[model samples]
Target: MRDPAQDPDESGFGFPAPLWRAVARRRPLGLDVRWRSPLRGPWLTSVLGLVLLVVLPVVTVTGLLSYSAYGPQFDQAYPGDVGFLRLPDFDWPTDPPWLYRLNQGLHVGLGLVVIPVVLAKLWSVIPKLFQWPPARSLAQVLERISLLMLVGGLLFEIVTGVLNIQYDYVFGFSFYTAHYYGAWVFMAGFLVHVPLKLATMVRSLRGTSLREVMRTGRDQTRPETGPSHGLIPTDPDPPTLSRRGALGLVGGGSLLVLVLTAGQTVGGVSRYAAVLMPRGRQPAGTFPVNKTAEAAGISREAVESWRLTLTGGAVEVSLTREQLLALPQHTATLPIACVEGWSTTQTWTGVRLRDLARLAGVTEPSSARVESIQESGLFRAATLQGNQVDHADSMLALRVNGGDLPLDHGYPARIMVPAIPGVHCTKWVGTIDFEAG
Candidate 1:
């Protein structure tokens, strides 16, 4: 009997015989080469799938929470709000101010860790990208489309997220909008792809043990059993890496990446261990700053002349720094958590915003628009919700960590509302325009 590997027509299986014969005759850039390694099969794909299935949801939830931290209640209030889903007024819970810090740290940390798994998963089934007669049926066509969406969406999101973390913007589109919408797109694809591959993944995982999988170098089933099995040519290549070795390398790399970058968010020992953090080590001061006063173009003269202005229904008051200091002082230890995933707690001292509201004649301010002296930027001004303004810890902070606030730490004054994102903690605060209830 002739060898099936040398007979394209006989071995083509579900694919068109003519296409297979043509492919066999051509040696164009080795694109027709199929991966026959047991490592590049459903077994490995299932392993990677299990890992991703666990991590992706964590990423998605944290991402949504970060977006929500931008004051979803003020979604329509700001022209730059990127959240498409105008979720109802929901203040990210503030009781444990470190809540945002924990969530964002997990988001960034887990995101970096998932990189190796995603790459390994893609490598495991890359042959499917070049399969003969790409779509044999309607189901196959839909599966291909869903896979395309999943792959493309994940790549887009991961790239954009990394870029944002490094403060790099190579794309023309808004990173916020693209990333926000891309998450949903990726999730939609993920939801569809999971169920479609569930049966295959279960079978692949249950088919063999780790040792057997590495040793056999092929599925346990015979080639005649299924089209996929027949696609593997009889010429078996020697294994370059064992199953355990491959998994170990990927997991180790992911853990290394996590250890190197997680310090930016994970405080204490991990913070020091994250030597590769893009922001560098936390700068000396009350805490690290994403933006500096100089970088924001606020002059010393502006700081000297800065006065806290308050206006709302039947209330208008402008208080000098001395006057603000004289108003009943309050202090709160709060964490400054940025969207980029770094956070540090500071002992903030200043007058409560509610007191300022009352000083301006409104006993109970529903909302307050905190404006910065910086003149321009996305977060130069932020709307403080009623709950945030009324929170006991809410205040316009002046001193930090028992000393005068550093210039980079929002000198003179800045908003310090609990359970809010760092960006919303408007720095260089110059005005507090309370909204009428």
Candidate 2:
């Protein structure tokens, strides 16, 4: 091996550093790779990396879509403060127990699968000593910056995600919340990765074969004269075992641990989940009963007359308080899975959104968007499609768990969307507007 300390003359590029030789020598001693199959090692590692980077994100996005549509039903059914339901904030798994359990299991299981795959990919690729030709000088800078960003983002997400599963230090921000937002950063980094990988692949295809390169060497030595132009270097160091055998041990062990950990986590949480499970009974009798009836200080009749108005974009409908109350109502027991990873189920009673849509002469669900008025007036909007409105589980809930809606829980009336996030199901709903598109 060339000693980096001996200042060698610069190659044509003025930077023929001996860094690679130094790195090769430092490769861990006795790290058994001999039984590994050369062909299977890189292939399996690449496939696993692709699955972790691509498939997992798609699943997470689908779940996020569901949460955005129907979260309130779950919240009312299993109030967080009551017990285990309260543990995972809207990010990790604290509210409804069942949802939390499912999300956590998926999160941790995916993490375990990703860790080794990421490690293997890094091992297999780093020694290639090849860089894609920059599209422009700025593109080269961006490429380097993106590489660093990918590493940083991956480390942060994986570490934070793992810690969240152990229920270890929360690091201040909510676990699931951080995970949710971190996804965007990770996604951006991922976008950059694709082009970089494509460049590497194109270069590889144009490069020499690994088999010929290996045949020319002492299994591990870098020949003073390198392989043909088409081949990239296979093993820059003492030919340790091929990566194929090591993968079997690593993959098998990882899968086993994932199964055991998943079982244990679910088993521990099932009892708590049972407590938050829905009662299955539906709402009956006077819907949206006045909260003042339970407390005499508030005017029952006047409060009952409160109306929710819709005005925005086009078509303003001002229904009298009575007309609003008289609209047809329906109820259902569904689960709310918060971003925090906790979930609960409850019986939600409210007017069927489709019934309200029909009364308002609205033929399509996509036309209307709902908003709510809170003390802070932070009204969030959600596009309510016709199918989502007509869904058997969807409703404009005015009651929770067979009782009057609590003030903290969007009393009077709130949209209860199924499989949607809590935020989109506006509380203390006061307005709806139909848009052109």
On TM-score, the candidate that comes out on top is 1
**Any runs in candidate 1 off by more than 4 Å, and if so which?**
1-29, 76-89, 209-234, 284-286
- Candidate 2, TM-score vs. the true structure? 0.48
Each prediction's RMSD over C-alphas, in Å, is: 5.5, 12.5
Query: Each prediction's Cα lDDT score?
Result: 0.75, 0.50
Residue 424 in candidate 2, Cα distance off native in Å: 0.4
Which residue pairs clash within candidate 1? none
lDDT of 1 at 132: 62
TM-score of 1: 0.86
Worst 10 residues of 1 by lDDT: 218-227
- TM values, all candidates: 0.86, 0.48
Query: Which candidate wins on lDDT?
Result: 1
What lDDT does model 1 reach? 0.75
